[model samples]
Target: MLYWTLKYVLLGPLLKLFWPTKVTGLDNIPKTGGAIVASNHLAVVDSFFLPTHVKRRIVFLAKSEYFTEPGIKGKFKKWFFSGTGQYPVDRSGGSAGQAALDTGVRLLREGRLLGVYPEGTRSPDGRLHKGKTGIARMALQARVPVIPVAMVGTDKVNPIGSKMWWPRRIEIHIGAPLDFSRYDGLAGDRFVERSIADEVMYNLMELSGQEYVDIYAARAKELADAEHAGTRVAVPMQEHARDATRTPETEAS
Candidate 1:
């Protein structure tokens, strides 16, 4: 299959040779069955490296734009992403978001490993961001465990807005699977979902030893961009609920 071919004979060997990745707690991943592999989104390459280390194929719900671009480059991207076990899903909110969650649940029910970045987007400042509750909902609905993975140093290798990748040491720390069976029937409850989402982020914070930001990564990016443009945007009151003990830091380039 194309996936194995790429992993074993093509891309995987090249990346391993250049990046020098170190993975720990890999045995925490279930040998077989549906489970959610929740991780912090550091950089785009996080997708590439994680899958190469895991034995089973990981199906990621990539943003639809990756599959819908025009022209020859777009065609190549579509073919490559599809061949590597990624499916396109609309990331727009409302109905599209719900539809993506449904697709993830369906995949889990079919006994496939679902890779998810609960932060919803890559961290704009190398700090862990609040997790979207969709991951919690999918796990509850699919009756699957959630495995937290921490990807360290990927941001350095694939810095945002940089076309070239640098050779950097990468560490992948896989944590024990989290079971939310106690909330088995509470999939649609927002409060319960938030609690579950927070728990996952907390584990990632500990695993990666990165500062935790309670705001969503998308919002942080928006704020950072606005600041860079010398404009002001109102901070959401809810984001102010972040821990007072933690001081905020400027966004990293």
Candidate 2:
């Protein structure tokens, strides 16, 4: 199959050469059936590293543009993306968002591992971002366990806007599966959704040790870009640190 061929036979070996991938608590992943692997998005490589480390084949929802480009490179991109167990979803708002979640739920119902970044996009400065409630909703709707995952040190290797990659140490931590049984039928409630999102973020914070921001990742990226342009804007790091200033209670929370 193209998946195994590209993974173990090709890109997998090359990935091992460039960056050392250290995975912890991989036993937490379920061997079969439907479950959600919720992860923190830091670098683009985060997508490649997390699922590959796991023994089972994990499917992810990627940007829809990848599936439909008008050239040879586009065809290759489509093949590679599909070969690697990724399906594209429209990133535009409204119907697109609903369709993505619907597809995820459908996959889970069929007993498959659905990988998702609750932040909706990658963090610009390697910090944690506010998680969307979609992951929680999918798990609750499908009645499956949600596994919290953390990927660290990848952003430093690939970084944002860099074509060249460097060797770097990477860590993938798979914490225990989070149980939302208590709120089994309450996924529709906003309060329950917020609580679930917080729980997912809590584990990611502990794993990656990145400062958590209660803002969307895409907005943070926009803010960071404005600051880089010398247009007089606030740095996301300092602002994020101010709220998540590392308190003992924060860890306990």
Candidate 3:
């Protein structure tokens, strides 16, 4: 298969030789059966390296743009992404979350390992951000365990806004599988779903040792962009008031 050949033969050897990755807790991943591999989004290379280190195949829900490029080079890009066990999903608008949940549930039901970043987007400042509840909903819908993974030093290898890849050491840490069977049959409850997602993020914070922020990474990026452009984006007073009282558990949603 192309996935195996790329990981073990083509890109894998070159990656190992240059980056020299260190992985721990490989046994935490289930050798058989369905599970969610929830990780913190640090860099674009996080996706490329995580799958290479894990023995089991990991299918990531990537942005649709990756597969929708134009021309012959675009065709090759689509082929490489698809052949590497990655699927495309549109990540725009409100419906995007639901679409991702549906895709993930289908993969889990098929007894496949689904790699997801609960933060929804990469950390703009390298700090772990609040997780969206889609991950919890997927686990509940599929009745699968959640495995928290941490990728350290990936941001250095390929940081945001950087085109060149640095030959820095990377570390992949796999934590113990987290069971959410206690909330079985309660996936529809928003409160319970948020709690499940918060628990997963808490584990990731511990494994990755990154500062945990109880705000969505996308929103943070928006505010950051506005600041950088010297444009004032008004924050509603009520929203600020609510943020003052926001708890970590409730923010995970």
Top TM-score: which candidate number?
A: 1
Q: Which is better, 1 or 3, measured by lDDT?
A: 1
- Report the C-alpha lDDT of model 2 over 1-253, residue by residue, as the tens digit: 8888878988788888778888899899998989988888766677677767888888887668788988999998898887777877765654656777878888899999988888877777778988777777888889899999988887788777776677999888899998888888886776687788888898889987889977877778887778888676654553332111010000000
lDDT digits (tens) for residues 75-98 of candidate 3: 988888876778777766546666
Q: Order the candidate numbers by lDDT, best to worst.
A: 1, 3, 2
Instruction: Kindly report which residue stretches of model 3 are placed more than 4 angstroms away from their true locations once superposed.
Output: 68-70, 90-94, 236-253
TM-score comparison, 1 vs 2, better candidate: 1
- Which regions in candidate 1 have their CA more than 4 angstroms from the true location? 68-72, 90-94, 239-253
RMSD of 3: 5.5
For model 1, residues 87-108, the per-residue Cα lDDT tens digits are 7766565455676787888899
- What are the root-mean-square deviations of the candidates from the true structure over C-alphas? 5.2, 7.0, 5.5
Residue-pair clashes per prediction, in order, are 0, 0, 0
Query: What is the TM-score of each predicted model, taking all chains together?
Result: 0.90, 0.86, 0.89
